[model samples]
Target: MKDSLLWDLSDIATNETFPQLIADTKKRIDKIVTWRKHLSPQMEKKQFVKMLNEIEDLKSVIACIYDYPALKELTDRTDIKAREMKATALDIVIAAEESVRFIDHWLQGKDVVGPEKLNDEQAEVLFSIVPEHKHLLWRSRELALHTLSDVEERIILQKDLQLSEPLLDLRRIIESEQQYKIKLDGEKKTKVIRTQAELSKLTTDANPKNRESAYRVLFKEYEKNLDKYFIIYQAIAKDWSSVANLRGYNEPISMRNRANDLPDELIDLLYSVCSENLGIFHNFFELKANLLKIPKLRRFDLYAPLKDSDKTKYSFAEALDLVIDTFEGFDKDFADKAKRVVAEGHIDSHPSPKKAPGAFCATIHPKITPYVFLNFTGKTRDVFTLAHELGHAVHSLYSSVNPYSGQNPTLPLAETASTFAELLLFDRMMQLVDTETQQKLLMERLADSYATIMRQINFSMFEKEAFALFAKGTNPEDVSSRYYQNLLAHFGDSVDVDQIFSYEWAYIPHFVNSPFYVYAYAFGELLALSLFAMYKDSGEVAVNKLKKILTFGRTAYPIEMLQELDISLQDRDFWMHGFSVINNWQKNVQNIFSHERI
Candidate 1:
């Protein structure tokens, strides 16, 4: 089936208009709050079950209400109506959070005086009435252990909704408003570049001058507003630290680790393993520098193509077909689900002015089809991105059998399918290309691995240090210098670490929007590498195991879910094994170059 180029949002609210949907959502919120306010420990099983059902319905309605505006805004950041709708939706949802907290507290039996555990029959009946509540119960109990009083929790929630969230939106608005006018070859007039998606295309331009100019213009524009970005980062960091301290977390990252159900030690181990194996990427960079015949690789040269080989742009249809075929080769079901994302009008596949720069799959609710937003430029990486986002959509579809609460996985496991999809696409490309093209493809694949794994890990390292510096009241300039040092550590002597690149951190939305979130990319990429190896060795059996894992969603802890596939996150050697895969690729590239020299 042919995929639609643009996503259809009408299906999300077919019967009602945006204002009507907002009003309906408010009614559901009222209903939920009323139920929660009347909740008591002495309530009967029937009453509890009724409340759970209402919560489930409320979740579905709220998800649609929030998601519609979110998707609309992302598709066109310039849309005033979309932005207003998003703010309205966020207001309603933030209010609903109070009710949610109450329910969770009650689920933890916090209000009960010497509450007794439910018998098996009673438990079974409760699960039967609201199967999703089974997952919610565990999460609620886990959160209850770390939760503060309702009053304190509300304060934090209010600060987040009123302060932190608005700051993030302001940063995005500022970024979207930036326009870099640069002269292009064969064009008499300077092209106005607004989105990062456009700037990205120029980063890989065949001309070194073009590449350098693009980098400078992009960074220069951001430099002009560096103070604002820094202030935003500072406020976010302080807010995060304040909340973390209040919650008794040792560090801001520790709070995130707890949220992901990941042990601090496991994350430490992963970071250490990746740090030790930085040499593999260093070697890749040295090789790239040699290929470019430069003394050292510049920041702009980082994404420079090894060869101008086959700049053939794939149309949206062709990209979709390629992605579907790659997934089909692995499993027809995977491909079918990916196709359904398009067929169901769930994918926005074109780039436009004021649209979000990157791609993402938003799984709003378990019952609702996931929506994917993409700024497709027809680059090969764009194809991989399409596959990646579609992989996320498929993952949501796989977990759709679960309740709304259980439909989304932890952040680390959330990236598993998306990165795995990229790997699958890489493998498919390797098979289709000629020997010379295979070498180029291999280099491209390794470049991606370095970007996704090492680059992200380096970003996390900067966050680790930046957080500490922020606590010490360090200025953004000092923090930028520290980030430069982090880049130096990653690149080592293989590449030139320009001073200007220090300002690059100011543009990273993750640091401000989601603190310490970059590490999940490294974690997911490494884990996906290990999982991809398992797929190659065990084939269909491993594929089936992966499908089962995706179906888990947030039902089980991430580590426990992986253990089902005989994968141990705590095993130090398991992470090193992912490095070994990269090392082998490095060796293959070395051998390819050696053969060419002869």
Candidate 2:
């Protein structure tokens, strides 16, 4: 399995097909519900413990049933069966919301015996068996304050799921149906630029004309279906707002921040720091434009390569070796865990027309190894992506000792390993490349940094504006206009903003799927940059600190976890320090250019 690049779902369920698996899951869910019905808050301590075990088992089964179909649909968006199965499974899981609420309610009740009440010996025994379960218990109690009544919760769950289906379907429609015909190198080519992954590569095409054509075509498709996409966006935004309001959240983003166990103030600080440092990226864009021999960068040329016809490419096998070796250099355990992902056939790394664009690492349950999905195109960036997603896999593996609920870090911390992996890969490339190629790599790294950090920060800004406008019942055109203005601010005068690119916001799935989620990338990249700086300064000690943080999973709050390394999320200066690192890289690029001019 380690030798294979494709994911083998057999480990999840081999005897049954997907349909059979769904049926089996339903039966198991019913049994759990039936068992749950027999229990009450008045139950004995022994019975309470038994119920806790039952809930854990139920969570594991639910995760197992949900993940395979979801992964299937993501791997091939055109698979109707996979989509249907995933939708059905999600509906079942939503229907079982009562069970979850019921357990949480019971756990929160005064009649339930808690760990503090137990004798020290008894507490020790429980801790030995489920050391992390105490955190889950505590979390449940915290959520209990926010939990709606079972009936109300079910209605909201159903409504959210129902609203989500169309968005998912719309995503499939866009990915599978969108096409753009353009002329390149005196040849007319028809490209099905559906996925962001494909459009991302196309945006960096060596030819400026090709890059412009790709951006125009990409946005034009969204513009063509503007009304439909707008309605979808409106529905999703309204639904999210209504839910957040009902949950007593101050705003839509507040709900997301709470879910990630982060303070709204911390995110605010992040955005504020980034917004203040926009000049750094503006300088980068201007430098890039100068390097490209253009007076000003068009939005399309934002990702344009500094050099024409860059020959850097890596085969999938070669990419695997490069990422594995990079990880090994950083930490042997990191490399070994990354290799296990490929070895266990937990990666889907083929390029196909219908395959979903982008890459992700999905960890279904702590007991099951994580799976990675990639649209590997053999590009040098693809190698970094390979490392990024595999970094997520390794993070999951490290936290496998946790229960399913405790295994995953919050969204910001979740990117810690993935972004760290990219940094390691960048350093490795620097060490191995000639001076000319090294400069190219540095330019590419700068571009990536801007993309991941400032770009995401700008997206967060757009979301804030868009959501505010949505609350006012702003029209789609008005929303698009606002988005265009956001882009103008993001690029400043360093790049030319096209009208068509205003329609660009219409295609960003995160705005529809996960509102206010973009900031996590900004949060993560900066955090990783800081952590990498620590690694450079402190070496193995920093590495050990990171390993400890990853292993803690959700047991500790992310802010508290970082404090172990003397990093403070609330410190504006700390975030500003990350920008300083970027500024240093910008200086390095300028130095290289000046030396070349000589």
Q: Output the lDDT of residue 250, model 1.
A: 80
Q: Report how far off residue 313 is in candidate 2 (Å).
A: 3.8
Please report, as a residue range, the 10-residue window in candidate 2 with the lowest summed lDDT: 110-119
| TM-score versus the correct structure, for each prediction | 0.88, 0.87
Clash pairs (backbone) in predicted model 2: 1-343, 2-343
How far off is residue 129 in model 2, in Å?
Answer: 9.7
TM-score of 2: 0.87
Over 4 Å off, model 2: 1-4, 15-27, 34-45, 69-92, 108-131, 167-202, 315-317, 352-357
Q: Model 2: per-residue lDDT, tens digit, 514-534?
A: 888988888889988888887
- Model 1: per-residue Cα lDDT over 137-182, one tens digit each: 7666666667787777778877887889899999988898899988
Q: Any idea what lDDT model 2 has?
A: 0.78
Report the error of model 1 at residue 205, Å. Answer: 3.2
Q: What is the lDDT of residue 279 in candidate 2?
A: 88
